[model samples]
Target: MSVSHLIKHSAITTGILSLASFGLAASPSQAVSVDFSSWDKLGDVYTQPGEASLSNDNANFQDDSPQASGYYNLSGNNPEEASPNPNLQDFLGLDAESLDDDGQAYEGSAIKSVITAQAGDKLSFEWRFSTNETSNKDFGFFLVNNNVIKLADFTNALQSGTSGSFQTNTGFNTFSYTFNSAGTYNLGFGVVDVGDYVTSSALDVKNGNLEEVPEPTTIVGSLILVSAGLLERSRKKARK
Candidate 1:
């Protein structure tokens, strides 16, 4: 083979080898998870608009009067405390009315993203829903995969719940759903002032994550090695 042809062939083989190596090492299941402690500060994996623009905070929102607390937090109280009061349950619906009767109205905040995933991967988050409207006017936690809506619970309505009065409720209220197929999905999480911000419903969402389930390294490595051999054979043929 001519020197130019050899160089060209070598370059092609190198590219193929590189791609094969990458494909084996980088499995869709092994993609990094997107975790969020609070909406204000999303980690490197997540993306969101300005906090001010999106009221992803522990504030009351309504049409007549919008109460923007201008703060982003996972819960109204310390999550680590023994008797931690997840804001979602402590201050919504009947409880909200007791504080301020007139403040009852629709209040909510939503953040969404397009996540690429593989089968066996999971999307999970911890949330507490507090609402008097258990039937219709309730908290909604959803994941819109493609065009289908997957509810965190059996229904869109999430009733009032908490970790407990004294014990720290770690993993007390968690929502997790595994992906069935490999594809792009639009995942979202938020709290809405169902019915009214007063007859209010609150949702304390935190530790949101997309868990990645990657393929075994040995399998990936084996595939790469096989591809490399093919490339080597092609190089020999070119030389001949």
Candidate 2:
């Protein structure tokens, strides 16, 4: 190959490499569409009409301020009125027979939302669990497609505060999940009264997000095609 042709080929390869580097370094992450108003109630009774709420203020647990938050509670005026939630039981891997009297009746409240994500996409959010229950059985948890991912047991909570009659934990914990395949998923958060339904427990969730991740193989494949096209052009010019 002539000197000029070699120079052109080198320039093309250099430009392609630079573009690939930039793309890998600065790939933009997209904002996930979370409809705060579209969250569906998952459990049976909510204690009161407004026990579950959507808001931007940090009034619930005095934790981090969020763009928007969905809160669910297991406390109310009447503790006996609280009923066992079958869906929550399913998520916890417990059966109706296991949640009988003898101070083991489990009641819970939760909110769920449907979201679409691509393979390798990441979903993340901040959650806080607050309760006045002295028993360690009462806890907070999250679910993906009705399957429990993590349980925030009362014994694990290191922080403590007060929110009305209930003792609160003002610390917010972050949770993240990466989808293995592209599809729609149901994401949910809730608080459960494990032993008895006397004391109230609440869950606060905020800043829900999903980020699209670019595959490295895809980027490499495009670079290979560009390199091939540029080399072909260089060969044709050399022939001339």
Candidate 3:
């Protein structure tokens, strides 16, 4: 081939390689599905440690760690003495207003699995309420991303929960998180508010679940380059 033709071919090949790289980056991240339903509650299974502070009457029934009960925990919580939301019972329409009513066990919740998603990727949750409250129980869910839950990020990523005491309650709350796809994150249950953050070694987290995005103009430029790559390739092949 002539020098000019060789140059043209070389440039086209480089462009193709560049476009493929961008496409791969734009692709979604791989996901890891974990199960902890059968995980055991690692503590004084029979004893309600935080009972007195939150409510001395906590767990009127079985309170062993759910892991001991033969189930995987999608999520779990071990509060440092905060009482189980009494509203959970009130919302149940049951006569009892708290888990303390029937004398149950207080098995700490568990997190069975984790998911890794990229920025702009929408990750959702399905909350299964296991509360015994038949009257006024209200449960909430929150996304603990890198341990940050400000109003801006919280509302942007996952459902924003109300802190403090609210008269309303629900069977379950489901929401989505718009991951920046940065460091790893752990999803937690229980009082999902500013103060609900708990530390645990057993929980699973996939790094880069919330990566921040490039500036708006940069993304637009990348898209334009991708489009141009496609158009140029088509033209060159047609002429060939």
Candidate 4:
């Protein structure tokens, strides 16, 4: 319970957390680039972080449903293309009938996938929005685990209003959630219509085959040094 003891324990606990993260990352049990149309089994598709194009289109997806099921409709997120939606210059359109004439298939649903993770798990993803949109606008993220304690780690609470694309962004605005208990949790994202007013988008779960990449040899050495320092501090305190 002493201050020095707490410091020593803190270092060890951090090492443990890092180890857990790496373990998850290394495990092949985590999914990667799941097909959006049938994403329930695996995680969902993330489109934007890809190189030239992003598509959860029925083009390669299972069921060929034209649109993925969970994308919520805000301004122009609807896939029907019955009315023309303004396209952003940098944004790619899938299932939107290739409004740019580049010949990319469009499916219109931005809800790429739904994923669930346990404590010490991190969820990282990317998304983009118009300069026309708010900076911190909620793109739709939720927690279903009854025992989750993201409250301690959240930079911001998961907001349910607002609409944009996270599943489609090439770079991710990652959300890290570490759970506190074991149970069947159902973390989900946008599929809500919300009466044609405001809407939200789902995150594309990626880098999901969680693995702890080995730190650089230098980092490993630094860790050893820090451990030694903690031990020295503990010994010094014991002498007093």
Judging by TM-score against the true structure, name the best candidate. Answer: 2
For model 4, how does the per-residue alpha-carbon lDDT over 1-240 read when each residue is reduced to its tens digit?
678687777776677456444333222234244233343221123333331112222222222123344333222223322124422111222232322221221222323234544544444333322111123232222334222111111113233333543322223445444445433444432211111212222333443332222334445555555766766666677567
1-240: candidate 2 lDDT, tens digit per residue: 888888998988887776666554333446664443357664432322222421111123322222112232223222221244465455434455433333444565556667888889987777776655556456666667746654565655668675542355647878788989999887766665665444555666767677788656466657766787987888898898
Candidate 4 minimal-lDDT segment of 10 residues? 146-155
How close is every model to the real structure, measured as TM-score? 0.42, 0.61, 0.34, 0.29
lDDT-wise, the better of 1 and 2 is 2
Number of clashes in every candidate structure?
Answer: 6, 0, 58, 24
Q: In model 2, where is the ten-residue run with the lowest total lDDT?
A: 54-63
lDDT of 2: 0.57
Query: CA shift at 208, candidate 1, in angstroms?
Result: 2.8
**Model 1, span 1-240: residue lDDT tens:** 778667766775676666565554544444344544333322111233222111223332231223333223333421110012223223221232222212232344444556688788887765654333433333334535423232222143423344321111122367778889999876655444433333333344555667788666546666666667766776777767
In order, the Cα lDDT scores of the candidates are: 0.43, 0.57, 0.32, 0.33
Error of 3 at 173 (Å): 5.9
Candidate 3 lowest-lDDT run of ten: 49-58
Distance from true position, residue 112, model 4, in Å? 8.6
